[model samples]
Every structure is written in C-alpha cells, then in structure tokens.
Target chain A: MSGSPGAGRSRIVTWAVVGLCLGLAGALAWAMLDLPAPSTRLPGQVAAQLERSGVEHPVTAVLLNFRGYDTLLEIAVLLLALLGMLAAGVAPRASAPLGASSMLAALARALAPLMVLVAGYLLWAGAFRPGGAFQAGAVLAAAGVLLRLAGFLPAWTRPGAALRMALAAGFALFLAIAALGLTEGALLRYPEPSAGALILAIESGLTFSLGLILAGLFLAGPELPRREDGGGTP
Target chain B: MSLGLFYALLGGGLFALGLAGLILRPHLLAKIIGFNVMGSGAFLVLVGLGSRDGVADPVPQAMVLTGIVVAVAATALALALARRLLELSGDMVLPGERLRPGEDDDADA
Candidate 1:
C-alpha cells in the first residue's frame, strides 16, 4: 500500500496519529495516578444541601436544582441541533407503509401505549429513584421509532404550527421559569416551598419536548430512494 | 489501584483508541462511531475520577447525564450532515480523499 510516495506519507501520518494518541494515554494515566485529592468534597456538599434541593435523589437534585442552568441550556442545545437538521433541506417524501410484517405491526400497536405509561412512571419516579426526564424521553423516543418501523407512524415532513410549538415548548417553559427565578433572587432558583412542584412541571414539559426532538432526529431525514442494485438494504 | 482509578485508566485507554480510530477511519459513519466512543470514554473518566474516593458523586454523575444528551444531539447533527454529503457527492467520503472516476476508492486502507 505504500509503494508510492503519497501512500508512504499517508502511512507516516497514520503512525504519527497513533504515536500521539499513545503519548496522550500515557500522560492521562500518569496524571490520574499522581493527582492531588480534590480541595472540596463535592459529594459531601451535595448531600448536605440535598434537603433543600427539592428532590430526594441527589442526582436529580443536582440536575434540576443545583445546576438547573445547565439543564436549561441542554434543552436549548437539543432544540438547536434539531433545527440544524431541519435546515439541511431534506424534505420528507409522502408516507407509505413500509413495514409489511403483521406480527411487528401488532406488537407495535400493543406496546406503544405501554411504553408511554413507562415513560410517565419514570418521570414521576425520578424524584427519589434512578429515573428522570432523560430516561423517560429516551423511552418515549424509542417507542416512536418502534412505531415508525412498524409503519404506524409517518415520517415527519414540514411540521405544522402545533408540532413546532410542541418542539419548542419545553425550552420556552424552562427559559420562562429561569426568568421567573431572577425575580425570586437568581436564575433557576425556585422558592423552597414550591421547588418540588416546579421541578415536576419542568420535567413534564421536558419529557414531551425531548421525546419529540429525539424522535424527530430520526424521522426528519429524507427517505433515500431505493437504488437499482439493491444498495439501500437494511 | 482502587476500582474507580482502574476504570479511569481504562477510560483513558478507550479515549486513546477512539482518537486513533477517529483519525484513521475513512468512512464517515466509522468516524462518527469513534467520536461517540471518545465521548463515552470522557464521561467514564469524569465519573470515575470524581468517585475515586469510593463515594458516589452526584455532581459529576449529573454532568455526565447532561453530556450524554448533548452527545446524542451532536451525533444526530453529524449524521444529518453526513447524509447530506452522501446525497450531494454520491459517496460517503470527504472531498479531499475522493477518488477519480474508474478508480476503486474503497480499495485503499
């Protein structure tokens, strides 16, 4: 492969990349071994402040209360990524039922509602357990994908005004609450009395929107036309 | 070494491997997979290092959760862009590496 000078150069470049990465790995391992202990114990701090953070689960408390601004921006970033996809100009074609298997269709029909219920349960359980908006939203998105695969759901084309509103609602609500927190004292700082309710409200909106956005990421892409040589096989 | 430190070192190894794959792979999809691997490695390192003392740290865990979602979003965007490239060029390769007509581009390493 390296008979030509150009190929030799490519090989040299590959070697250089490999060498650099090996050095990086070595440095990282050395640093990890020699690192000083953290100046502050963050877990202790999080535990100490958990009572006032509005969630029984420390991770949830840290996510939606102590570091809510990050969550808020995260949703915005998701929305922006969806927007970037939409701007790529892959207009979806007219929907046709592609999944012809009766068993798959039947399974999707039976499971979609159950998946929604599971998503809801996860969102509700997040306050005190290992479940939350991200997990719930991912489950919801998976349901949507399953339905799409079963030909129960249509590919997203130009989303109507209602759909657009649904896509943005979570981020808008999050931003509005953050602004409200400014009046309360600082951004995203809820009153201790209503913190739980506020987080619940935010999570609910986020669940719906995040689900739609994640599903849209798959559904928004244009359906590739089938190649003559059977090139687009699944 | 503690379990957390061991995992941290493993994560570092994964990061290096992923970096190598990202740089060496010619296929856009493979590169995307490499990028995800790198992100996973970084997330593992963050959590592993934060918990090296044997106590679970909520802050880093929460941050990793956020990072996972962002990484998903970024992956979606990268895929969308790659699909566009494939559509426009009729090949899933970058412009600089594109082979001329009548030549087998996929034959090289």
Candidate 2:
C-alpha cells in the first residue's frame, strides 16, 4: 500500500499529526496534576446531596435526579442518532428463516428470557445499587441483537407507528414531566415526596425507549416503504 | 506516581495510540475502532483522575456511563455511514479515487 510515490509525504503528515496529538495529550495530563482531587469538595457535596435526591445510590441520584437535564439531553442525542439513521434510509433486510438453525433458535429461546430477567433486575436495583436504565436497556438491546443474529426479525425493524411510539416514549415522558414542573417549580423539579417514584417512572420509560432504539440501531435494515396492510419488509 | 496517576498515564498513552491509529489508518473501519479506543481512553482518564482521593466520585462515574452509551451509538452511526459509503463507492477508504477503465467493473465483484 505504501508503494505509491507520495506515500512518504503522507507518512510524514501522519507522523506530524500523531506528534501534535501526543503533545496535546501530555499537556492535558500535566495540567490535570494541578487540579484538586476529585473527592475533595464538589464530589463530597454530591455524595451529601444524594440523600436529599431520594435515592441511595449516589450515581443513580446524580444521573436521574440531581443532573437529570443532562440525562434528558443524552437520551435526546441517542434518539436523534436513531432518527438520523432512519432518515438516511438504512433499514434492515429480512434475513433467511431461522428454522434451519435449530441450535441458534434454541440459544435465542434460552438466552432471551434470561436477558430480560436480568434487565428487569438491573432496572429495579438502580435505586440502591450500581445498575440503572442504561445498563438495563443495554441488556435488553443485547437480547434483541441476539435474536436478530439468530435470524429473527424484531417488530421494531419495521419502524411502524407503534415502534416509533416506543422509540419516542422516553423523551416524550421526560419532556412532559419537565413541562409539568414548569408550572409548579423549575423544569424537571420533582416533588420531594414523590421524587423517588418519579425517577423510577422516568427511568422505566427510558429503559423501554432506549432498548427499542438500540435494537433498531443494531438492525440497520434496507429501506422499506410502509405497507398499508401492516406487513413489514418482505 | 500514585495508582490513580499511573492509570491516568495509561489513559493518555491509549489516547495517543488511538489518535495515531485514527490519523494514520486509511480504512474507515479502523478509524471507527480508533475513535472508540479514544473514547474509552478518555473515560479511563476521567475515572482514574477522579478516584485520586480514595473515595470514588459518583458524578464522573455517571458521566462516564453516559459517555459509554453515547459512544456505542456514535460507533453504530459511523459504521452505518461507512457501510453506505462502501455500497455507493465500492471502496472502504475515503472517496475520490480515480479508477482505471476496468477497475470500476472489477470493484463490483
């Protein structure tokens, strides 16, 4: 590949870029040395504030309550990426029937429910443990991926109305809650008494939406026009 | 150096490696992998730097978790784009290669 006449010039440019990147990274590391330790002030305050956030898990409280707007925006970004993909017409194609592969079919059958159970547990444990919506959603997405890899076409592959609703459900619910807060308190300000429940509701919705979005993303199919007869891509 | 600082250095090295790969590799798939490596390195930097004082900071951990999820999404998008490019142009690298008369026909294979 480097036999081309201009390869040396390209090699020189690549090395120059690499050198520049290294210098920048070194500067970053050095600059970070002067900063106060992370557990000093703000993180300590965050730890203290977790109690008031109505969650035992500090990370969960931070992600879904204290700095929920960030989570909201992150979800929007994920959704936006999915939307962009769909708009770009990268749709899933119908794979060959899975009946031929009894082994894969049996694997999907065995693992799918187990993955779902784990996802559920992860979602429920987020209030007090390390798991949360994203983790749970990821597991759920993995299940979808496993099924797809096994030649099963999930309903979301069609991007039908119901699938679209499922995809947007999390963002819609989050915005609705935030809008409600605008009338009572600041945006996304959950009532203190119900903060835990509210967070759980939002997370549950988000998990479902995120799971669908992720699965849809993984199954980037060939574009198929919507069928009036409710038949997905042939 | 302290353990945290050592990890930070490791993160920096990984970032450099990933950056070099991203810049030097001609293949789109390699560039995508490089981007992922870079993202992971940055996450490592965040986690490592934030854990200096014994107590792990949950804030940065949460942020890193979010970053990980977003990175997956970004990688998927990049892969989709690369696949589309390959479908259209029949070459995995960036476009604008002037093909010989018979090369385009060969590319279809």
Question: For all the models shown, what interface RMSD does each have?
Answer: 1.9, 2.9
In terms of DockQ, which candidate is strongest?
Answer: 1
Checking candidate 2 for backbone clashes, the offending pairs are: A91-A221, A91-A222, A92-A221, A92-A222
Off by over 4 Å in 2: A1-5, A38-40, A91-100, A154-157, A223-234, B96-109
Q: Per-residue lDDT tens digits of candidate 1, residues B8-107?
A: 9989989999989887877788789999999999998999998899998899999999999999999999998888887777777787764423235553
Q: Which clashing pairs does model 1 show?
A: none
**Fnat for each model:** 0.86, 0.56
For candidate 2, the clash count comes to 4
A88-122: candidate 1 lDDT, tens digit per residue: 85644443436537677678878999999999999
Across B70-108, the per-residue lDDT of candidate 2 in tens digits comes to: 888888888878877776777678865333334335434
TM-score of 2: 0.86
lDDT per residue as tens, model 2, A111-204: 9899999999999999999999999999999999887765555444347788788899999998888777786669988888888888898999
Error of 2 at B30 (Å): 1.2
